[model samples]
Target chain A: MNLPDRHISLAHGNGGRLMRELIELLFAKHLKNPTLDVQADAVTLPLERHGELLFTTDGFTVQPLEFPGGNIGSLSVHGTTNDLAVSGAIPKYLSLNAFIEEGFEVAALERIIISIAQAAKAIDVAVVAGDTKVVRRGEGGGVYLATTGIGIKTTEINLSMSQIQPGDRLLVSGPVGDHGIAVMLAREQFGLRGDLMSDAASVLPFTQALLDLPGLRFMRDPTRGGLATVAHELCRGTGLRVNLDQSAIPLRDPVVSVCDMLGYDPLYLACEGRVVAVIAADQADQALQRWQALPGGELARIIGETESNDPFVVLHTELGGSRILDELEDDPLPRIC
Target chain B: MNLPDRHISLAHGNGGRLMRELIELLFAKHLKNPTLDVQADAVTLPLERHGELLFTTDGFTVQPLEFPGGNIGSLSVHGTTNDLAVSGAIPKYLSLNAFIEEGFEVAALERIIISIAQAAKAIDVAVVAGDTKVVRRGEGGGVYLATTGIGIKTTEINLSMSQIQPGDRLLVSGPVGDHGIAVMLAREQFGLRGDLMSDAASVLPFTQALLDLPGLRFMRDPTRGGLATVAHELCRGTGLRVNLDQSAIPLRDPVVSVCDMLGYDPLYLACEGRVVAVIAADQADQALQRWQALPGGELARIIGETESNDPFVVLHTELGGSRILDELEDDPLPRIC
Candidate 1:
């Protein structure tokens, strides 16, 4: 069946002929897989052996539809899968939900769908089930995606914030705030432009390398509220003081320049493809070496450490001055992920 | 932390203090379960045994957010779980994604969250994971929800549209079009009002009773595009003619009256909580008896049958005349689901 319209219409979501054609010619064609059956309401997934299952979900509404390094499609896939990866699980299957606006360009939708398929294939995960809905033109952003991921835990590594203890060290996989600055530049809302690309890729390699380390207490991808927000969560979760050496943290020049010019703090910006890991001080160097050797982890750093029980985050500046980093209050960026 | 504002702000989704408070005071407070941890990046789900896993997803963007019988929250739960139910699986876990518009009322959001928790509790399904995003006011319909369900196929009954034979009988668990008419009435679009309620309940009881039946060929919940759409799918899928006896198909009085007044067809309307099943001709009576004994299935009937290899749907009217029911074209109601 051919989709005769160049732009989506309300009829495309009415669950009728148009909807079927949209699914057949666009979504189904691009995301074709053995597990995806348009005729079946539910798809069956084969589990070789189920010991433990990891489930996570995330919603994406990044503006511009297309960003420098990734669009909402690829970002949605990575956002959900990264959550599972950081939790020490082998990402397996994902279900997608797309809420599109009427009058959206069909060609752009196809591109986004193709990106989704590619990103899922990159991680060897299947887009097993999906749904699409079109809202009235003004009632939705150009496109919004939500993905729910199912992963299997193949190892005995159990990571959680509750496992963090005083004297633990914190390491970041790579530079921070690239995704936030890149997306901001794509928006062009501030009369600024740059060639910076979003750091929006699956963090599976970083997490997998450290899954075998017994000292790895927890791992989380610094996303919406960025590195400082993650530190706040750790302090609140473990009631321990988090001390960060600001000079040790990695940051790209473009991101730092953007932040400096816009009065934005890079530490509170989002990063899609970075990991903040809490590890025992004894194994911190080993963890840092492993990440630094990976493709995207050349700038990986042992950025901080946990101190006595005070439940606060402290940033030690390069000039030998220390200041408490308050929990994020106002939103500097919205719809970032 | 107390929410001082009555309406949602962009910061509530920015992964900051307000977002954390919103989750803790609203979502976490209402949908508290042992498996749900707001601080965790991903949650671990325990599987007692290995078996076939059923996965399905659905997006909900019903207008008026709150309708007659139920709101979008409960409807989302029923919508995704019903897909699993009709597939002959026992729904085990669900992951929810909410996209909220800025300036939406906090109290109303709480109400919807409470409803979601209630609906999940009613079915013994755990909401294991969730994510929330807030968009600018004009970029979203107050609240759009997407739910992905995971189920375990405990029964040996394998049902599919391909299993439907030419002589199979079609049974409807109850009346059609109540949800569509009820929502339309709630909208008061045409200066009309009615006390009719939506038939938006889970079809688990109906599907469960017939799962063991040897003659149960296929089962589907008539949702958006309603029973006629399901009939159309049956014909197109199996290359068989669908003959519906309009006189035997059950519909409520208010729904019929609304359709008659509005030039609408009940068969094309949506039904949130009803089942359309295909059974062997010889076992049609047995299936009807089983459904009729259930509380909500009192109006069950053998409404149609499959015949020949023409791939079309024909409605046999009460006056002994028949007309072809064409595939749905324009959307009568855009956000009914």
Candidate 2:
């Protein structure tokens, strides 16, 4: 073993010799940024002297760590950023906690770290701290990630749902269901694909751009149960009716066809690189154009509006009628983003 | 349907009607908080204008959610808080992400949520956001909790290993291995118990007590792989050696005897609610006294010193011999959180 090994075995995460060797060699070698090398029991980060620090934590258990359009490494970055972004803060630092299965390839681990580093750099955030542990075989499903983000909030922004108004219009940036379908196709679990790409980009910018807009009540990334679920949430939380224009909702032909084939509704599918906005009626058009200007938000459009009557989500049909959109019975797509 | 369920069944964790009904009537009924009502794709929170928010997240998967000192619910809170506390932050908020097995029981779920609420109340941390999902019957073990906490960090405190020197003193806040051993005893798989109770309590006060002490370099709870990993870690990182007086290392007699019986070292075992501190050699005496005055830190002791030799952790054994302390060989105390 004079030459360093290039993979993480069960022992690497077992808190034993291999674990030490792995950290001393692989992770510590590339992760040699200033903070981690301090080797403290816990990190003492460089704190901001002025405003309040915003903090958030998230855990990821998406079955396959590597997926189409993205992997767990990139997802971890986006996941943490999204949390801070929705909290009305600018994510500046992150603490990553990884639980890995034994026998994960060292090459693969390096790839992941490189991916994480690249993603972190892309988002302009730093991986300031981390902890890694290995679970025994048959006990873990390859890998799981738990990341905590630290952000600094300025005095200017306050994004809260309690501030939502009665007549605010709802807008969604870009076409939906791409991310859900992309992962599904990547799994090849369904043996389906057709120009469907995972919309797994970060929403930090889109939301950041709209922060200064006048009367921006609330903004959300339609993940998990997607637009329909979030739309239902608006009505339920604010006791307002939301009437969605079916034609106004952007969708790719491939996503629609796939949804039709699978008996899944595109409206209810997850969208990672999308934004759901609840803005003042007057600024709705401006928000749409602003979103369109961003790389990830080309298909921006006005999807719906909040109303006093009905007090439920009602979708205006392409056939000129309306139908009540109930809360999603179940997630049509799982492990998306 | 009429007979009360004795064990967890598949319908409880399913995201179907049964799952919704169980959450609404059982878990939600007990853990009711304005923020817990979130069903949105992402929760929207209002941050205070002045306070820095600290956030941390952890995934709870300790074999049995219902354990000796606490269940998964409470453990989730404690585990997350410990992570946040070790960072020298004041824990203020938490996000609970639950992955429940399809057949989980409503009654068990209720017990878990109540424990969570109690844990939150005990720490004065609010459960501000959460996500719940149900897996298929065989997809999950029982219930896994991923709790994320947020806390505000004070700007003045600077705790890092770079502060350690050759003459720094080592301290342990309380007896070690109690929590790890207690969990194993509860499993009864090894048919062992020895008056060992869990050291599972909030250590925030103890941590806060030591933050600003002039002698402090860094502190950490000797959890997971316990004191040895951290002791070895201090030396390994800063190129300094740590020599611990075994006679001074506090351990309950029962814990000592049990580790002896199991062919393990108490130094390598886990401590749920203890802190290991590095203090200036001159101030070690007063630091020990302060720790001993606290309920959680009552068993605190000055057990070691930083050195340039034995980059490995060296113990001055009771029998006048020494051993090169290494990392955990295997998970000696599994599910011992």
Model number with the top lDDT: 1
Q: Mind sharing the TM-score for model 2? A: 0.87
Please give, for every candidate in the order listed, the TM-score of chain B alone compared with the true chain B. Answer: 0.98, 0.91
Top model by DockQ, which number? 1
TM-scores of all models? 0.99, 0.87
Q: lDDT per residue, candidate 2, A188-292, as tens digits?
A: 778765656677777788878888886898877776667887887677678888889999999998888888898988888877677788999999999889989
Give per-residue CA lDDT, model 1, range A1-337, as digits (tens).
Answer: 3344489999999999999999989988888888999878999988767458889999999988899999999999999999999999989999999999999989889889999999999999999899999999999989999999999986477888889989999999999999999999999889999999999999999999998899999999999999999999999888999999999999999998999999999999999999999999999999999999999999999999999867889999999999999989988888788
lDDT of 1 by residue, B1-337 (tens): 4444489889999999989988889988888899988888888887667568899999999998999899999999999999999999989899989999999999889889999999999999988899999999999999999999999987477999889988999999999999999898888888999899999999998999998889899999999899999999999989999999999999999989989988999999999999999999999999999999999889999999999857889999999999999999989888998
lDDT of 1 at B216: 92
Q: What does the lDDT read for residue A62 in candidate 2?
A: 60
Q: Can you tell me the CAPRI class of model 2?
A: acceptable
Off by over 4 Å in 1: A1-5, B1-5
- Write model 2 residue lDDT over B1-337, tens digit each, in one string: 2224644444333233444566566566666666554443333344453444444445566656676777778877887787668767777777776766666775677788899999888888888655565554555546767776666677566677788989899998888888777777677777776566777777788788877787888877777778888887787677888998999988898887877888877787777678888989988888888888987677789999998765778888899998877656666665454
Off by over 4 Å in 2: A1-10, A20-38, A44-57, A86-88, A162-167, B1-59, B83-89, B133-141, B148-156, B296-298, B308-310
Fnat of each prediction, in sequence: 0.94, 0.10
Error of 1 at A193 (Å): 1.3
